[model samples]
Target: MSILIDGLLAILAIYLALQSLLAPRLSQSVFLFFAFGLALALAWVRLGAVDVAITEAAIAAGFLGVLFLDALRDFSSTISEKHNNTEAIQSSASRKKIKTFLLPRLAFGVGLGLFLLISLEAIWQIPQGGGLTAAAESMLPESGVEHPVTAVLLNFRAYDTWLEIGVILLGLLAIFVTGGIKIYTKPDVVAKDPLLRQVILFFTPVLFLFGAFLLYIGKSGPGGAFQAAVLWGAIGILLHLGGKPVFAMIPRWVGQLVLIMGLGFFLLMGFVFMSGGATLFEYPKAYAGTLILIVETLAAISIAAALTAIYANLNQMKEEPKENESAN
Candidate 1:
């Protein structure tokens, strides 16, 4: 039964992934990608990595799905505004020509086949039952957290985790550079439905409570900072959709501070530990668990803020004026 279930999940994941890439319409591809993400999450669960499954579902299916839909909307509007029917038809014909080109398709198929064979060979070469499992298990007692995943992430390899948080901030910075630091001065044009408002009211507190619960439970289970961050970020998105932009209501400096709080605190703690003759991010055994909890808490908050800011910026992005409009 387990084997059959795993086989079905594997097939579904592969099918969705291929379809997402090859779909005829952009909207179709985006929706297919969401399905692929969900399928992948199920595969992860079957592999007993519940934490990874949760992160994959939340970030890939939830956050990225929204981002892709927003991009699609902008892309479609721009295409409609900039190109007439004749140009659109010509472009479509050119794409069809490229798609039907025999030589290019043949070469791509050959290359992909070779790549798949190489990947299979590499996977087969990997020695089974030969990883750091034993070592990690032995060191788990001293790593400060009951959950091995949490221990490895927040204690055994904390520097890597710290860098991961920094990377998220850097991504946000890159988005800001591209979009020129858009601060939302007003709420987005959301639907003025009473049910939408009611939904937001109902989920706001629930999401907060759930996010905090996940953060606290990470010490012993398959919940952690990243998972909690996604939930908290969802709250910001909900508020934005409900015509109450949280970041817009707050001071710019305050928003910036929140964005940097996680990475800054992480580095400060690392340096403080280094000053006491310990290696950077190497917490003393006596205070390791407490310190990890504090770091995770701050990292969650910072990550949530960064994600919300990203969504807000992307949502508020205006299409550039066309040449005729600009001339006028």
Candidate 2:
């Protein structure tokens, strides 16, 4: 029965991947991609890696899925509309070119297939996990965290996690510095829908509570900063959908502070430990859990804020000028 379930999940994931790749409309592709992420999460769970599954489901399916969906909506209104009329003219011209291009494409496809087969053969020849599993388990007791995964992420592999936080902050910087996105000066119109308002009200507090719970349990279980951050991001999206921007009332300096707090604090702690004659991020055994919690909490907040800002900015760009005018 277990093997059958795993086989079914693998097949479903493959189908979803193909659908996402071949879907003509951007919206359909985006949703199918999200579905693919969720299916992969289930596969991870079946393999007993709950932490990875949660991260995959939350960040991939939740955060990235919404981001793509919003971008697709924006694209349809801005660029796609302008090209709609010209598409027919382009189509006729493109068909003649496609016939001429088919032979080359078929040749390229055959080459790609051969390359992939060779890659898979090489991967199969590689040795399976041996050293890392034994090392992690042997070192787990001294890591100052109850869960091996948490200990690895917040302690043993701290540098990698720290860099990931920096990458997310960098992404927000890229979005803002680009200057193509505009913040809405007015409330969004979606909040006016009574049903939507009620739904947001109900879910908002639930997400907040759940996120905090995830953060608290992360040191001992599968929940962690990334999962919590994604939940907070969902909260931000709900607020935006309800016409309340995530940082609407936040002052600029304060907003910037919140955005940088996670990465800054993580770096500060690393340096602090380094100055005490230990290497960077080498917390004393007694203080390891405390330090990890502090870093994770602040990181979760920063991640949530950064993701919200990104979504709010992108969503603002999607609102039709007519909606703004009507709101006015």
Candidate 3:
């Protein structure tokens, strides 16, 4: 049964990948890429890697799909019939007149020789990263999570999680500091297309249920803070794009405080706990589970807010101010 499922999923993945590569419409290709991601997630699950399946599903199928759909909608006007039709003309001309590289023949020979030598060395080199059994075993007890990857993500490699949060927050800040904020309610942005509105309405409830399930299932298998939060963020972005939710701005102070609160809480908790000197962020073995839960909750909220704020700001930048025609 498992082998049959894996084989089917692998074939689906290949089909989606090929469709994505061949599709002429950019939006169509983007959606095919999303299908490719979903199929890859299924392949992971079939291979008994539930944790990787969930993470890939969240990052690729959920978050990335929403990003591409929204951005492609914005670019739809910029891509018109003239641009779409020019490819055929260019391809025919290119076939008729294939130009040689302007590089000197001697330099081309030297470059080809160097590339062959490097390719041979690369083929012969032994990869060092395949063995993680020792690291995984050492961290598993400290992780309190069943999946080794989740354990590493939330506990053993918590520092990477901390820095990734910072990177996301920094990206949000940079978007705002530039004129990239479109903080008004452009609720009709995607509603202008009824098909998208229908799609969003259909998927919103499913996403909410799935995201919550992922969060609840974290302790046992693959689902966890990052995956659940990303799913939530994708749902929010979709609803906002579909005219169901309006983008709004809060006071600068509130935004800044919320932005850092997760990291601050995490760092402070570590300081308090590690004072006994096992290591930084170390809780007593008895309390480790509870402490990790607290940290994950904060991390989830922080990531969701950071992503939603970016969506709000991007809309703010694109929106035109409307005059108040409200009743006097």
Full-model lDDT for every candidate: 0.86, 0.85, 0.73
Alpha-carbon deviation at 188 in model 3, angstroms: 4.5
**Model 3 bad stretches (over 4 Å):** 1-15, 76-130, 186-212, 238-252, 320-328
Return the TM-score for each candidate structure.
Answer: 0.90, 0.88, 0.72
In what order do the candidates fall by lDDT, top score first? 1, 2, 3
* Backbone clashes, candidate 1: 0
Per-residue lDDT of model 3, residues 1-328, tens digit only: 6678777887888899988877767777888898889888888877778878878977786666666765674675444545645764566565443333223556888999999899989988967776987979887776776667666776777778778888888988897888545445657857898888889989888877887787767766778777877877777777777765523445667766766777888888878867767677656777767777778777776787788777666655434333323432
Worst 10-residue lDDT window, candidate 2: 76-85
Compute the lDDT of residue 116 as modeled in candidate 3: 89
lDDT of 1 by residue, 196-314 (tens): 78888999999999999999999999999999999999999888888888898988899889989999999999999999999988999999899989999999999999899899888
Candidate no. 1 TM-score: 0.90
Model 2: lDDT equals 0.85
True lDDT of residue 150, candidate 3: 65
Candidate achieving the largest TM-score: 1
Regions more than 4 Å wrong, model 1: 77-100, 319-328
RMSD of each: 3.9, 3.8, 6.0
